[model samples]
Target: MADKIRVLLAEDEPSLAFIIKESLETRDFLVSIYGDGEEALAGYRKDSPQILILDVMMPKKDGFTLAKEIRLSDRNTPIIFLTAKSQTSDVVEGFQHGGNDYLKKPFSMEELIVRVHALLNRLELPVNHKEGIAIGQYVFNYTRQSLKFNEEEEQLTHREAEVLLHLYKSRNEVVDKSVLLKELWGDDDFFSGRSLDVFITKLRKKLTKDDKVLIVNSRGYGYKLLC
Candidate 1:
């Protein structure tokens, strides 16, 4: 049997944290729980879990502080913020402190699972140069910043590549516009919002050859890449 993946979960709400821990354990994850960020950080230093699920607002230290402390020594471990903060600034701060992903409160278990797997995939894959990610008929080369479909190849700008990679990773699921803006642009200003629209249009045109692959606008909500 393979070893279970270790998870360190820190949240002040006992009931919610318990539910999350049990759910993850049932999925064969080895979960260690802490009620405060201080304890969580200590556990992280001692046990060194493969991933962290931290509440942004916790007693003592706080999730953002813990993340920064962890990153000071080890930047490889994936951190996911389980926060109630939906503000663009808060989300951006989460990323700046070394969070790979975040889930706002009142979230579904299914959503948590999807985000976890997405982060895990990036961690498990070899760094520096991955072969590519296949999206229907298109092959996206991350290192080369190019998308290829049959005989055609299109080069992508840095921002375009970043946006496309996020969409591709969360393919078939709607990713909130605010989430993308925070992760990529660091804020949800008017200019960045317009830029995202432009990038989406460019991506849609590039994948025109593949009828099964498309970036779908979720009508005032977000976008979903259907592949």
Candidate 2:
């Protein structure tokens, strides 16, 4: 039989971690759960896992600090940040520090499974492969966090790059406001919805440099990238 995908989960909440661990196990994933960041990091060093699921707040080391530390040594392992803090700044910080995905608290097990698979699918791509998504005449390089148009290049903040990339991926389709809020801020609450609006406005301003590119709003529904 094929070996199960090994997962290291670091969540301070015992019950939550237990639930997550059991769910992953039922999916045929081998999971090791830890209640603190320090112990989780230690566990990581002891037995390297295919992926890491970390909570932002923990008793010892925080997830951001832990992810930063791990990035210094191992840059390839996918790290998913789990947190209740759904602020835009917090989300950006997680990506800047090497998080591949973020999930807000009170998330469903099904969503967790989908995210895990999505990340693992990316990892399955050829080594050293980088995707530069095209937006009008501009090419957005996600790995370098840069957007290029002709000879000019704009370096995007981690959050900006992520938001733009997602919109570009859903080009011509209305990406629900809640989707962006949940995917980026990790929540679809009122505050996150407001933050999503700010991000969309910011992206619109930046992409306005290209006449053919427009981020269209769907009134009460969502936003779409029309190129």
Candidate 3:
């Protein structure tokens, strides 16, 4: 049999955590469960699981902080944030802090399972190759999801890499706002649009090493990546 897919689950509520742990275990996953962010961080360091399901509210570090920490070292692992906060800003914050997906409180096991499988499928790109796309002063490796400038390397989330790659493909042209959103996020709705803005901001920051490289916004239409 294939090795069981490892999963790290950080949830503070004992009952809810138990439910999540047992559910994933039944699905042939080896789940390392932790009750707080700090413990979860340790579990992550030790297990290096393929998937991480983090509760937004936790003792010590919280899911957003934990995700940020993990992104610092491991950008490829998929993170699904569990939270009761439904505001658009909260959603943006989760994405800003490196969450790949967000699940609201009281979600169904079936939906969670589908999300887990979906992320695994979506983010299974090959990595660590040396080939890179020359983008001004930065070398962006889509496979590795990293942008390197001189000696420093900025790790990008899978979504960010995807967006950057897409923009690069159509550099110097205005990529329609709706088109980019629909292609990347599978939705061009207001919430997803907001998330896209956050990603664009992050990419702009990383590309700031070379001021000539810019993602210029075309009001009422789209964006153009000028390199």
Candidate 4:
């Protein structure tokens, strides 16, 4: 068998932590569990893992602080935050602290596995000219949060950039509305649904400069960006 994917899971809730650790281990992942951020950070310093799964509300040190510390030493390792906090500011802070993805409480094991695989797939990709994505004629530099078109440049807001990146990743495939809502906004409530609609509309207008770009809505399904 291939070497297992190393995961540093920092979660204070013992029951939930055990559940997550066991689930990942069942899938052949090598999980190093920690009950607090301080211990997790110490473990991180000793042996950096391929991925980090952190709970936001932890003792000794919060996940955000630990993430900042990790970011200072490594920028490419994928970090996925698991939290119960659903506030927009909290989610924004997670990303600002170098989180690659976020999963709210009550998420299924299947969803967790899917997200972990997706992050790993992204990490395994080669560092080449194709590192970023192109939406129609607009060049989206994910790392820089900038979009350029015909010598004109526009900076995307955090939400806008995240939505665009997810759309680009799905490419020609239909991205389910629920998936978009959950992945980007961390919820599928009515307000989040409306917010997603607005962002999609804005992205469509931004890419309208190129006639080849189209963000097609699927009614009951989701949206697709075809170039």
Candidate 5:
């Protein structure tokens, strides 16, 4: 059997942390859950995991701070920030501090698993890989978090980047809202649902210049990224 993907999850919420840990473990992932960023960082130093799931607000140290430290030690290990903060500045700060992905609160386990697998897949790719995906006339540089339309480059927020990348990867396919919520937010509650709607609106406006790119709403079903 292949080695299980090791994950270090740091969240102050006990119930939520338990759910996330159990969900990941059920998928054969070796998970170490911590309520404090300091403790999680300690465990990280002792034995680095394949990925780190961090909550933005925590005691001792925050996710952003820990991420910076982790980056200093290990640049390649993937880091996913789990937070309730949906502000554009907060999202930008997360990516600036080296967050590989960001998930808002009220996400579902299913969505988390999908993102985990996606990050792992990207990490497993060879270093020389440089294929930039084309979304309409824009070239999305997933590694650099830059979207280029014609000669203009737009820097995407962490959450925006994750959402866009996932959509691009699932091109011409229907991406269920529940799946996206579960993967990105960890819970599919009302607030997160609203948050997802806001992001979808923002992304739609940003990609409006390209008539070929469409984020079709499927009413009760979910969303479809049609090219």
Candidate 6:
């Protein structure tokens, strides 16, 4: 039989952690819980979980630090940060530090489960590209989550890759902001809308090497990727 999908979860709150573990277990996932970032790091090295869910605030080390450290050696494993931070800058930091996705505190178990399945499905899917799609002077490798421009390359988080792929599919046309939020984030609430803006800002910076590439905002409506 196939091995159960392993999940390494690090969160200090026992009640929340328990709920997450129990929920994932019900779906046939094997979850190992750690109460601190340091412990989680050690556990990750020893057990090699297929995915990681880390709380942003934990003893010994924070989620951003843990993610950055893990990324020094491992880049493919998906990471989802659980944050209570409300600031947009905090979310940006999480993404910059190698987190592929995030869940705000008080998130639904169903949503968490769905995100888990989505990330795992991405890992299991067949290779997306051998050559990659061209966007202006850049080559986007969806499977690798990378965008290359000449000698430089921008490594994208899972969320960023997914966002870029959606825009790429409908390049030069306006893709409604609400559609992006609903499709990628499961809702178009205020928080989700702000998060989407943050991602677009990051993507724009990465593609700045070529002036021909632009992710244009459509005046409170949507965005158009002109390349």
- Output the number of the lDDT-best candidate: 6
Per-residue accuracy of model 1 over 1-227 as CA lDDT, tens digit each: 99998999999999998899888888898999999999998898888799899999999989999999887767667788988887867875776687767788898887787777766765554453367788898988865668999878897754566688888778899999999987665457675688689879988888899999989999978999999
Candidate 6, lDDT over the whole model = 0.88
Model 3 lDDT per residue over 7-93, tens place: 999999999988888998899988888999999999999898999999999999899999999988777788999999989889878
Best candidate (score: TM-score):
6
Question: Which wins on TM-score, candidate 3 or candidate 6?
Answer: 6
- TM of each candidate vs. truth: 0.61, 0.68, 0.72, 0.66, 0.59, 0.81
Model 1 scores what on Cα lDDT?
0.82
* Candidate 2 vs. true structure, TM-score: 0.68
> Candidate 5, 91: how far from true, in Å?
0.7
For the record, the alpha-carbon RMSD of candidate 4 to the native fold, in angstroms, is 4.4
lDDT of 5: 0.81
Better of 2 and 3 by lDDT: 3
Residue 188, model 1: lDDT of: 73
Error of 5 at 191 (Å): 18
Q: Which of the predicted structures, 1 or 2, would earn the higher TM-score when compared with the native?
A: 2
Please list all clashing residue pairs in model 6, or write none if there are none. none
Candidate 4 segments whose C-alpha is farther than 4 A from its true place: 72-75, 86-89, 106-111, 122-130, 133-138, 141-162, 169-179, 182-187, 194-227
User: Lowest lDDT 10-mer window, candidate 2?
Assistant: 121-130
- RMSD to native, candidate 6: 2.9
